[model samples]
Target: MPSLTAACATPGMRRLRILPACLHEYRGFSALRPWRRPDAVLGWGRKPTALKARRFAARHAIPYVALEDGFLRSWGLGVDGHQPHSLVVDHRGIYYDATRPSDLERLIHAAPFAAEELARARRCMALIREYRLSKYNHAPARALPAGDRPRVLVVDQTAGDASIEFGLAAAATFEAMLQAALAEHPEADILVKVHPDVVAGKKRGHLLEAARHHPRCRLVGEALAPWSLLDAVDSVHVVTSQLGFEALLAGRRVVCHGMPFYAGWGLTDDRLTCPRRGRPRRLEEVFAAAYLRYCRYANPYTGEPSTLEATIDLIADQKRRHAQLAGDWVGIGFSSWKRRFVGDFLGARARLQHVARPDDAPPTAGIRRLVWSSHHQALEALERQPPAAPLWRMEDGFIRSVGLGVDLVRPLSLIIDASGIHYDPRRASDLERLLNDTTFSPHLLDRARRLRQRIVSAGLNKYNVGTPAAGLDLPEQHRILLVVGQVESDASVRCAAPEIATNAELLRRVRAAHPEAYILYKPHPDVVSGARLGQLDTEARRLYNRLITDISITALLERVDDVHTMSSLAGFEALLRGRRVTAWGTPFYAGWGLTRDHGRHCPRRARRLTLDELVAGCLILYPTYLDPRSRRLINVETAVGLLEQQRRTTRALPLPQRLYRGYRHLFIERH
Candidate 1:
């Protein structure tokens, strides 16, 4: 065998490209069509796509290569071009098609493993097993069947698929293997795991009705994740499925009835053999060649070439997020437009029961949790007779800033917890508790610091609205102070700033105090978009040097030396940018010795806080941010990435959408 690097560097290697370059995505009715020309052809498979590409390549002398998805695939649907995180592109031939000597077999036999390569392979293998990750990292469809007896899982494959035709060489092979498993291990609990495609109605399988009812047999029809099945069973019986490879990865006994690439290797109990694969190999050697050396991976988040460790971390994070999305639905009492936003942001994970009024009981069928606003009428009704389900308080995030110029708005960030909300003055909020506590982990602080740097550098704010703040002029001799305004009727101002009732009164006070300073007043997005109150009259507009409405909050923060706000998150954003902040109201971010507070301060928050600590509590710990695209709960780091992408890619709303928004705005204002 040649050096893998040398093989890749070969001029001919450039032409030795893999085909059906990617799996085609399933878009339902629109996607149901015959396979068109692919970038190259995938070979030796009985599937229509594979057979067509194979013939076309041969007929036209087009270079074609065959490949298999490597160990860690993805957390979503694997086939149909959803994109695999890892794959084994074979130039010689498809690795599973036992008729030919493939590059994988040659590499397994002859590729020299340095100590570093072996160590890395071991680490990669450990992560795969630990996470129970696979080509698609999904939770099992059903629990493992209840039986104390030793279990033997007979993995089924799609009939007429590539693996069945090329490796098994017989159509009836799956049935033969199932019968053999039951005959050999008669006392064992024989669980025949059905193919996912078969369960999805996308493909056919070989499971007979008669075999399913056999006393020892329990046809495992659930779309259980492959890894979950592999982990539960003592041994795996297969006629060439990726599950056999995964079973080997998990150190389970693998009995291959047909020649999979992993089968001919001495580690597995093989009923079929590849004569060319004569050299016996260890798991790490095979893994190192197939995964670390052979496969190509693109990070699902960034679409850049990724390391196995990074991909594993990402998959694990997504899995947790998916689990979060699947949690019990919360019956939110009383209706607000924001409730719809909450449901959309939370995605399909938690169910939202939008009760039209306090008298409306939540749907009894699936209601186990309750969430409501602090001042909502439903809160009073629930207090009269508390339900069995736990209650959580929901509120907006500090950086909830983007939908300013238009009537449209979304809570890109929100908080939901058992503790009181951030703006509430009556009870201690979760954020206040975090801020006052001194025992936060060093790792949490470090993460906050990194997040702060990322947030600042990316120029991301709640709204990410507005154009360049570039040309706005500041007089050379005076200090520039930004006066941030908020919705006069918003709950935060009503609760936190009792003294400063209106934007005009707040502006008058700020202007009188900083008479010499260049005051720049920016109205809240809702005000600018005419969705809510706080629009200034012509006489009131002249109180500031300039009334800024078009520039981005981040840009304005960068230009100003100081920011004064009632309880606007702009003060917090300015704090992250190292600007001096003066608070006219006792916002959650105040009284930690971080700002000059005028209204109120929590006696509990006596500790002088770092920006990261503040960030950890406010942004990381407290809020639930949803990815605008995926609509799943994402970490602040991921949120920053998404928001930055949003900032870079955000365009003016479509005319139709804008018109619809106007109608929605009128309805909202009236209500």
Candidate 2:
């Protein structure tokens, strides 16, 4: 976008584009570039480095805006290092400095609380409580000490902080806050909560050590979530720390020793008052003022404008996955190439150690063992785990990648099944329970429908490699049945279709069943590329009316009237395309009402399902899709959108990857 460089020449500065350069020395600006030329200069509060910007603006006679981190700032601490997710652009003044009324204070005083805005604020507050989230989410939540005594939290802050300098606080203020907490809650246990920066050794705080230790005094030194502690406390004390504001949200009695932005608005028990902040405000009102109105949020994952609720969801999702992966993990029997991509899905916090045998996994309380789902025997053996050690089976999802996994292309989506693997019919998988027991909400069904529409509209398939071909000419007035092929020795075929497990057998059976129908045989891409097993001999190859090797599976699905398969993913894709599907063996999509199941009955999968329900379980809920670029877990729609764009640009592999794949196909497969 062109910068408003010529805006200064106009009579009024209506279109001024403010540009910030090297705003903070600690965390250099990761802001989106708009620096063609600045119509105005931007400076981060009273930081020493911002003097250059202020001087430049004064010399150039350009207007300036003050910037600070929004209340919903980041998943990491600023003092440690962070690129904030939200920023408050304050033209009036920064929110921290109490000498002047910042834009946030104005919003708090005057902004109308429309029903929609209040409703959104309520929902956001509920989410924060449910997720136990904060500005920084890396901290672990530990159980508070057991006692009958009431708990009082004394929140600490980094010394020489700007908030202290401007929020009418000093060194004596901290000591006074501690003395007040001791005197007010004499019987309560005093949890002196230190600053996160203090815990991290990044900076020193006001209350560095015990001035005079009491029997009730306990220094909270670990990097822990404030709400986790807040929930267990009866009252909170702070000298301009944000936790005092959060204590108000937690419904605790707050004693503010300094005039923090949240203080003197009839919210906190303020020792010093801001005469300008005299109006009474509800917690939701304050939240609405700070988060929804004053702050401008951008999604860290996708780098786009986002709402508070969406950012909360994003952070909560990451936190939940991180907590799961926060423990020691042992990946059993993953190939060397596959190992490189596993951590993207497992989590950045997980300490992953790949091993050859299941026994190599430490049988510790916080350890988890994961095996590739195709290794059924090993997963079966590992399932008899002792207490506290979790086991999961991993497999590629339907919308896998733009190129074949057999060709060493990294997959976008994979299923992390805590129950049995999806393809296995001997027992129930998480997908089976999802299909059997889940009450598919209208919202989810609609999402599934739209996702299916997007997939069909984009003409996307599992390995989106082939281009859409022109419709194949066939005998008129005859039903067309597509017989899908799979790797003969694959686990799905071995478990579900022992009788009709091979491509030749599947083709012969289909041809005999639909003798008059025009039959087209579509072999698995792995077999076509000579990467894995399965292909037909000369006599067996003649069992079909036509063979489709070049056209994309999506194009073939659109052209075919019906589909026949012995446990192939293409069968499910065909169902998504709204075709009549006959499963010779039990695929995950089979045994539900969707497909005609001719295989061994799965007593567990007895529920009838709509097409959308099948999609909700298999595509939406069961799989975890990771964005290769962002390394962030994305929803199916995002994965599909990425796949569509990639398919358009990448119908064929690049030279280096192609050469590498060729070498693997020839040398590795041949061996």
Most accurate candidate by TM-score:
2
- Report lDDT (CA) for all predictions: 0.70, 0.77
TM-score of 1: 0.70
Each candidate structure's TM-score, on Cα atoms with residue i matched to residue i, is 0.70, 0.82
Model 1 residue 450 distance off true place after TM-score fit, in angstroms:
6.8
Candidate 2: stretches off by over 4 Å: 5-37, 74-83, 196-202, 356-367, 375-392, 417-419, 428-461, 469-482, 508-520, 537-546, 555-563, 571-581, 591-595, 605-651, 667-671
> Where's the lowest-lDDT run of ten residues in candidate 1?
24-33
* Per-residue lDDT of candidate 1, residues 1-671 (tens digit): 22111111112222222212222121111111134333344442333445544566666565556655656776666333244566666667767778887777777877569989999899888877776777776654345656788889888776766777778557677778888898888779888878656766777888745346888887777667776676578898988888888889888998988888787768899988777885778899988887777676654443345567656755665565455555565555534656556775454445666655545655354454455565566676665665555556776665554554234456667776566678765567878887887565565677678788888887888777788788988898999999998988787888888888778878888888988899999999767766666787676687889999888888999998999999888999999999999999888889888898887766777788877888878887667766555454545665666566666666786676577567756886547
- Pairs with backbone N, CA or C atoms under 3 Å apart (clashes), candidate 2: none
Report lDDT (Cα) of residue 552, candidate 2: 86
Candidate 1, number of clashes: 11
**What lDDT tens digits, residue by residue, belong to model 2 across residues 441-461?**
665687688878888888888
